[model samples]
Target: MKVFNEIETAKLLPMRELMEALRVAAQDCVEGKIVSPERMVVALKEGGIMLSMPATADDIAIHKLVNVNPRNSKEGLPTIHGQVVAMDALSGVMLFQVDGPTVTGRRTAAVSMLGISRLLAHQPKSVLIIGVGKQALNHVEAIAEIFPDAAIHMRGRSAHGAQMFVDQMKSVAPNLRVEEAGVDHDVVIAVTTARSPVYSELAKPGRLVIGVGAFTPEMCEIAPAIVDASTVYVDDPLGATHEAGDLIQANIDWSRVKSLASAFSEQPDFSRPIVFKTVGTGAWDLAACRVIKARL
Candidate 1:
C-alpha cells in the first residue's frame, strides 16, 4: 500500500475539496448510501482511549484507528495519533494509508466550514474560535483557506496561550488576533474539551455557533441557554444523540434537532439563531479518503 506522510496527507485533502466531499458524504449518509456504524472505543490505563471507525460506500471503504492520549500533552507530544487505511470495497484490497490525525483534524474542521457555508445566511466576516488546541489550529487554517477574506480571532483560557496560538498560526492566518473586539463575531466556534461551559453567552440572530469538541456527555463547551435559544443542528444525526455533550447535558429534545443533510435540503429560518454541533462519524473519514484516493 502507498503510505502518505502527514504533509502528503494534508496536500491530498485540501480544505475546499474535503469540504465538498463531506457535503456529498453527508447527503449519502442521510440517504443510507453509506454504511458507518458507531465507533468502538476502548479505554486505556492512562485515561486514553483507542477508537476504531469504519465506513463503506459505493466508491470507497476506509477504517481509522486512532488513539487519543490526553496525558501526552505533558510530554510535549501530540495528543492524538493513528493511521487511516483505504481499500477497494469489492476486492477488499488495501489501496493506501494516510495519517489518521490529519484526516480527523482536517475533516472535523471541514465539517465546521460546511456548516458555515450551509447554515449562515451570509459569509462570515468575523469568526471567534475558542480553544488553542490542534482543532483550533485546523479551523484557523481551514477558514483562512476557504474564506480568505474573513477576519479570524482566537480565544484561550489565558492571554499568553491565545497569543502563542496566534504566533503559531501566523503563516496561515497572519492577521489572527486575540478576540477582544467590541463587534460581535459572525460565527463562534467552541473547540474546547472543557467539562464546564466555555461559551455561555445567549445565542443571537445573525450569529452561528458551532460546537466541535466535547464528545462525551460529561463535557460541554456551549451553555444550555445558548442551545435553548438557537435552532440546533448536528453533523451526524445518530452520533449526536449519544455523543453531543452540550446538547445532551442541556436535555434538548432529539426530535427537534436537525441533521446537516436537512440544512442542504431544507431552508432554515435565518432570522433566528442557529447552533451546529458536530460529533464526527466514520462517514466523514470515508469521504476524506475518497478525496485523496481520487488524486492517486
Candidate 2:
C-alpha cells in the first residue's frame, strides 16, 4: 500500500476542498449513505488512548487509528500520532494511507468551517480562537486559507502562552495577533482541553460559537448559559449525545439540538444566537480519504 508522509498528507487535504468534502459528508451521514459506528477507545499508559474509527460508503471506505498521549507534551513530543488508511469498500483492499494526526487536524477544522459557513448569516470579520495546540494550528491555517480577510485572534490560558502562540504562527499568519481587551468577535471557537469552561459569556446574536476541544463529559469549554441560550447544532448528533461536553454539561434538551445536515436543508434563524458543537466521527475521515483518493 502507498504511504504518504505528514507533509504529503497535509498537501492532499487542502482547507477549501476538505471543507467542501466535509460539507458533502455531513449530508451523506444524515442520509445513511455512510455508515460509521461509534469509535472504539482503548486505554494506554500515562493518560494515553488508542482510538479506532472506521467508516464505509458505496464508493470508498477508511479506517483511522489514532494515539493520543497527553503526557508527551511534557516530554516535548507530539501529543497525537496515527494513520488513516483508505480502502476499497467492496474488496477491502487498502489502497493508500495518510498520516493520522494530519487527517484529524484537517478534518476537524473542516467540520468547524462547515458549521461556521452554514450557521452564520454574514462573512466573519473577526474570529477568536481559544487554545494553541495542534487543533488550534489547523483551525488558524484553515481560517487563513478560507477566510483570508478576517482578522484572527488567539487566547491561551496565560498571556505568555498566547504571545508565544502568536509568535509561532507569525510565519503562516502574519495578521494573527494575541487577543486583548476581550472584545466581542464574529465567531468564537474554543479548542482547549480545559476541565473548566474557557468561554463563559452568555449567548448573543451574530456570534457563532463552536466548541471543538472538549470531547469527554468531564471536559467543558463553554458555560451552561451559552449552550442554553443558543440555537444549538452539532456536526454529529449521534456522537454529540455522549461526547459533547459543552451541551452535556448544560443539561439542555436534546430535542432542541439540530444536526449539521438540517442546516443544509433549511435555513436557520440567524437572528438568534448559534452554537455548533462537534465531537467528530469516522465519516469525516472517510470524506478526507475520498478527497485525496480522487486527486491521486
Among these predictions, the greatest lDDT belongs to 1
Instruction: List the candidates' TM-scores in order.
Output: 0.98, 0.98
Q: Candidate 2 on 1-296: residue-level lDDT in tens? A: 99999999999888888888888998898889999999988999977889999999999999999998888888999889999999999999999999999999999999988888899998888999999899999999988888888889999988899999989998888779999686779899999887789998778999999999988777899999999889999988988998898898899799999999999999998999999999989999999999999899
Please write out the lDDT profile of model 1 over residues 1-296, one tens digit for every residue: 99999999999998888988999999999889999999888998687889999999987899999998878888999989999999999998999999999999999999999999989999999999999999998999999988888988889999999999998888878768888858689899998888899998878998999999888788899999999999999999888888899999999999899999899989988999999999999999999999999888
Task: List candidate 1 segments past 4 Å from native.
Answer: none
lDDT of 2: 0.91
Model 1 has how many clashing residue pairs? 0
Q: Which ten residues in a row have the lowest lDDT in candidate 1?
A: 174-183
Worst 10 residues of 2 by lDDT: 174-183
Instruction: Give every collision pair in model 1.
Output: none
